[model samples]
Every structure is written in structure tokens, then in C-alpha cells.
Target: MAREPQTRAETSSSPLEPRVREALGQRLQELSYSFDEMVLRIPREEMVECCRLLKTTPGLDFKLLRCLSVVDYVDFMEVVYHLSSLSHPHKVTLKARLPAEDLRVPTVTTVWKGADWHEREGHDLFGVLFEGHPDLSPLLLYEGFEGYPGRKSYPMPEQRELYGE
Candidate 1:
């Protein structure tokens, strides 16, 4: 069965309730808007601090890093991190938007050690540079790969060059 889309109020629940967004907004004044009803759009510069609070805050301890994905929106890029609390049954999506010119954001490895791989994959696919990442080496792409294959502007590699068939 298909579920109906939820309103902003209904989307943000529990761990990432409005209070949490308000708190973050108080600390970081760059809370423009949400990418999705449930997804909070945090500034790229404040991503690390936001992740820290999400992991350590009492009722909103989002300790598990579910996944990290990068989106190329032509004009800019967006990094999304899905977080969940192991001790509680709550989850939220955190996002940081970056300009195409400066595709750098602080690594969340300091907050969640497992973020290392996710950061690497983001870097490999979208050309996002996770500053302070221990290893931003390719996770899916090999060395000498010309450009980010995941980007909308990256040209598709020739099949003959790839397979030599």
C-alpha cells in the first residue's frame, strides 16, 4: 500500500522534532529550510557540530549512521545523512548543501567512526571533499578515474575503453 505524504509537522517526529531543529537553529543561524518535509537543511559549515549534538544529546541521541548519499543538483550539491538512535525508536535525515565550486564539508568520522566509509564513497562518487577525513580514498572508483561518474555533468566512459571488447 502507498502511504500519503506527510506535512512538515507530521514528518518531523521524536528524536528530530521541531524542538531539535529550533535548538539547532538557535545555535546556527543558517537554517534556511528543509529539502524535504522530514529532512533538515543545515549549512555545510555547521554539519559537524550538528552531527555532534545529534549523537550526544540526551533524548535525541542518534548514534547509528544509517547511510550517506550525495546529490548533484546542477547548480549545487547536497549531502544527506540518515541517522537513527540505537537506544530509541527515532530517526531523522540531516542534509548539508554545498556550492558546485566549493564541494567541501567536514568529515563526520569524529562523531561516528563508521562515517569514514560513507565519506569516502561520497568523495569518490560526487567529488565531495570531506575535510579532516582520515581516508578519502576511492570506495567504489579506482585510482586515476578521470571524473566523478556520479555527477550529472560527467561524461559516460566509453565501453570499449572500459572492457576492451
Candidate 2:
């Protein structure tokens, strides 16, 4: 039989949960557990600072940036960062939501150098502008490619011509 989903209170019993909450403080919008890993949601404005703290904090040292990607939800876009602690058996998924009209967020490269390419990919595919990113050059797409192909609204070449997009 399958197990039931865990509620916030049920998952809060993990030893690292309290520490993560304390480290993030007011910046943390929501915290919960999924698939045995912690998930943190923070405002786009606080992403860079939050990432830095997660890496530098004493007990909750999330030193590894496992992945960085974006999900287009039609109305909004969600940026997800998977972070893991090398010294401890802890993993966290950090997320920030951006409005469709304003797809901009501060770069986490300042906190994790490995974010360079990931940021570029997000820019190329999702059209997210990573402010303070050293280079936002095309990573997966060609330099002159039109509309973000990764977005749900992106039109095909024939559709674009027919619709005058």
C-alpha cells in the first residue's frame, strides 16, 4: 500500500527543519517536506541573500547546488534551486515565484559560482532575466532565437507567421 502525504506539522519533526527555519527567518515564505526533503519558498527579492545564508550558515550548511531550473505555470514562473549539504544528510529545494509580466530575479551566481550555466539556460529557455548575472548569453538556444521555447505560450514558426507574432 502507498503511504499518505506528510503534513507540515508531521514533517517538522526532522532535526534540520528547525535549523533551516531559524537560518532563513522572515525571508522564508513557506517551508514543508516532500519526498523526505525540505522545500523552502522565498520571495524573488530575497533569493540571492537566502542562498548565501544557506551555504554559509553554521549548522545548516547547504554547500552544494544540485540543480537550478524554471517552471512556467502560464500565469507565473517558478524558479527552483536544489541544494544539498555535503557534511550532513540534508537536502532542500528552494523556490521563488516570479510574475509573468516581470520575469526578473537576482542571480545566485554571487552565492554559488556553479549557477552560471544554469542561469544562462533559464534565460535562454524561460526568458528569465537574472539581474547581476555576469553573462546571460544563449546557453541552449542560438544567439538570435526568438521567444523562449520552454514557455507554454511560445509559438511554432508556422504559427508565428500565421498569427503575425
lDDT of 1: 0.78
N/CA/C clash count, model 2:
0
lDDT of each: 0.78, 0.88
Range of the 10 consecutive residues with the lowest summed lDDT in candidate 1: 1-10
Instruction: Provide the lDDT at 143 for model 1.
Output: 88
- How does candidate 1 fare on TM-score? 0.79
TM-score of 2: 0.87
Give per-residue CA lDDT, model 2, range 48-108, as digits (tens): 9999999999988889999999988888888999999999888889999888899999999
Give all TM-scores, in the order shown: 0.79, 0.87
Model 1 backbone overlap count: 0
The sequence of per-residue lDDT tens digits that candidate 1 reaches over residues 26-143 is 5453332234335667888888999888888788888999998898888888898989888977777777878889999999999999888888988998899999998877788888
